[model samples]
Target: MQCPLPRIAVLWSALLFGLALSAGTTPALAQAERCPKLVAGNPFLQRLAPRTVPAAYVAPRQVGLTYIGHSTFLIETAGGVTVATDYNDYVRPAMVPRVATMNRAHSTHYSLNPDPGIEHVLKGWREDRDPVHYDLDIDDLWVGNLQTNIRDWRGDTIRNGNSIFVFRAADLCIAHLGHLHHTLTHDDIGALGRLDVVLAPVDGSYTLDIDGMIEVLKSLEAPVVIPMHYFNESTLENFLTRFAGRDYAIERRESPELVLSRETLPRKPTVIVLPPGG
Candidate 1:
């Protein structure tokens, strides 16, 4: 039986399609023309920004995301459901997520001893099992995994499984292609269905190379793309160069977190640079 699309996915698809058609008539606009040029800020960039409640005129939403260094992220949906990805490193000890996802490719991606407080712990890599399937009801976050391996620096075949997580939340169907090493095939797109946002690694080393990454992104046709797994400024600059003339908007927000709704999403594919804390 085919799984039903999550409510958030349906809402996001309708909103993105409507906005795309409307935005096609108007000229492209940048979020801010004077965004600071690419520069690596200090470690102080890790502090969370002061929270300001949005006005009543805007919908009251409570989605929260915390960056736990590297590719690890802690996301709390508006419904108070918390989900974490690639929970490892010293930072993992600091996070107390309701659900945690870990991949077996690198030590940084999985914790040796799982957190005792976490209710759910998912291991993305398995030796003989098929992909793991999960349907989260608290916030309607649906996640599915595919069996894939990563290559080490020496180009040796490392037997590991990378989980491609699909999160349906807040009118957005976002896919996190965790440690993907090859271009996506036709079946992969079919499995993904419709993707509005894609979290991809653009380091051009651990994940696919620059050109390979661009190809995969094009095939997915996600309206928004967030690049991760790159260190400092130089890596981000090299990744953006691939889409120099594309009809894309680059936004470097002073804060890492953004509040997006059906009406607020952009028409074309947007690249949002979330500062460290976001």
Candidate 2:
């Protein structure tokens, strides 16, 4: 897992810049404090864990997420392994990801020729009738996906054509809804278990309608939801407007990247709008 030096430098610079912008009087100390030392499992994640674990807990790992325009996001784990979700030709992270997840609902959601440097390439769909399934562990990071359907170019129904990629690391379960065309059924929800964060498509017309996406969000009830796949400000605003007077709070950020740990998660359900790139 040797990452290109230029890519590592770029990510480090962006991270330091974000740290400088924090609302603390001493930026250096603030950054140091917010960036916790290496730990095992996040304590806050215990709340969402299944009943199988023991009562004691270790500190969770820290992970960073960077929006790379459209539906592509770079997810970096504390162990240094990285994953790109909904990878396509139009947008890609500067660094070659250790793993890449793809959904072929549209040209923008997948790439036919992924880089050879990537260790694992997970496709959300398959030409065969069998469902696309993935359960991969890249170091401490665990990645999986749930099958979903999509509409073909001729608007014909294609079953099990899309996937909602789930990343479990740092003691948190983060889900990316890739080109989702419909709402989740009882079984879909059951398979998803619990999601701490969700990256959702908000194009309204292209994927599920705004109302349907809203319903899907309500069903998951994740602590943090990030909007993606929207084309213009109007589309984004329309999606945000629908959440008005609801239990969700909206916050627009100037940067495309953010680091997250269970300890830093918001207490309430919040919609965070991140800029399009690092």
Candidate 3:
């Protein structure tokens, strides 16, 4: 359900969720960083290279992720849990997602009138400056948020206006950076724990600059990195150029969906280019 966490509360959603909570970069995230139930995001821990998404949903120990243009992505878990990241009215999943996450950057990043079918709606920002905490554990999936500040069009900063949603599924930990405006801090990286996959924004000016975003990715050290939120091929290519092919093996996917499992993860860090549109 509908779990309205205690206002001004940190990782205290136990009343409804009864699971440990994490809200983007808040002190509460340290809890999830230490939770044993969460996935250990080490792609190299497995053997063969990753596999692709099949027509059928993923099997146990596998997660299917589909990019729905812009910053939205549909995350499917082994237990049939569906999570829509950066969910907005303009860009959304073909089918209604079980959980919808939104940021306060703009209308394109969130929807005021979300579908009632969505069982959980996690908003990144609050009216006050306090960061929002969400620790939703249903079936075999766990979703949490890391709140970060964003710069408005007026060049002013909105503290905790954006969030980086983390999804722990099967044996993979996937992170989606939502409307991120700046580089991360030391504490920010520590709270994120280890990430197996990262869906990052590559539009230099609108989001973080290419170099800064690269630093953030390097810090997370995820084996697989997917590019999103870029305007055109030029910008995406520019960001890809920063990574040396020797260290990061770049691959292009024909489809927008990716089926990932610990046993199929890459041996080294890879920057995957998934076809745009879900």
Candidate 4:
């Protein structure tokens, strides 16, 4: 007998969840913590260790992240919610993400016209330059953001001009550095708490200088770092060279997608490079 449309959709979602779990991408959804109290001087920042991967990437406990060129990443949570980071008019993922987060450091970081179908549209900067505070629970995921400053066309400071979006799902905290212009502050670090994964810009000249970006990454101390906003191979290579023989382990994935969970974070810090997706 043919399955009903709704039944078929559910089955497909379940199947994907199972596959993700088997791939070590499982998230302990129920155990996932809300943003903990902000604290400065976390010990984890001083240590780098190797991590053990779960069996494979599977769902419910794991999430699938695909790089969609520039700084946009399609974050697929185990709860069937999808988020598009740094969504802009220039480039976007093929799939319609449930939520879209934008930063306005440049026109490329945001879209003037997003799909009306998207349930939640998050803008990192406000007209008044006040902080863009986002804390919402969608399905089984909790999404939040931290305000940061950015430089405008005339090199003037725009307070709260950008945001670092945080995704809490499957017992993991992932952050996307959106059009980041300067090093993070102590208060920003405290607000972020702990992060398992970070999506950062390595353009060196445009976003944060290579050295300054390195400093920021070291402070966050997330186990996994994915580089974005690179201009070309030379820019990427230049960034990679800075981490040579450092605490970070560099791995270039075959594709623009990665499946990850808290359990699979490398024991030592790692920088995994995924090619831009068109």
lDDT of model 4 at position 77 = 73
The weakest ten consecutive residues by lDDT in model 2 span: 25-34
RMSD of every candidate to native, in Å, equals 12.8, 15.7, 7.9, 13.9
- Model 2, stretches more than 4 Å misplaced? 1-60
- Candidate maximizing lDDT: 3
* Candidate 2 lDDT, 147-240, residue by residue in tens: 6778887888787788788887776778999999988765466456667889999989989999999999999999899999999999999999
Cα lDDT of model 4 overall? 0.75
Runs in model 1 deviating more than 4 A are 1-63, 93-95, 128-130, 152-154, 158-160
TM-scores of the candidates in the order shown: 0.72, 0.79, 0.83, 0.80
Q: How many backbone clashes does every candidate have?
A: 1, 4, 3, 26
lDDT of each: 0.60, 0.75, 0.77, 0.75
* Per-residue lDDT of 138 in model 1: 40
What does candidate 4's lDDT look like per residue over 126-198, in tens digits? 9997545677777655687776677777888887778788887666789898888888655456456678899
Which whole-number lDDT from 0 to 100 does residue 227 have in model 4? 94
lDDT of 3 by residue, 74-100 (tens): 998766778888889999888988899
Ranking 1 against 2 by TM-score, winner: 2
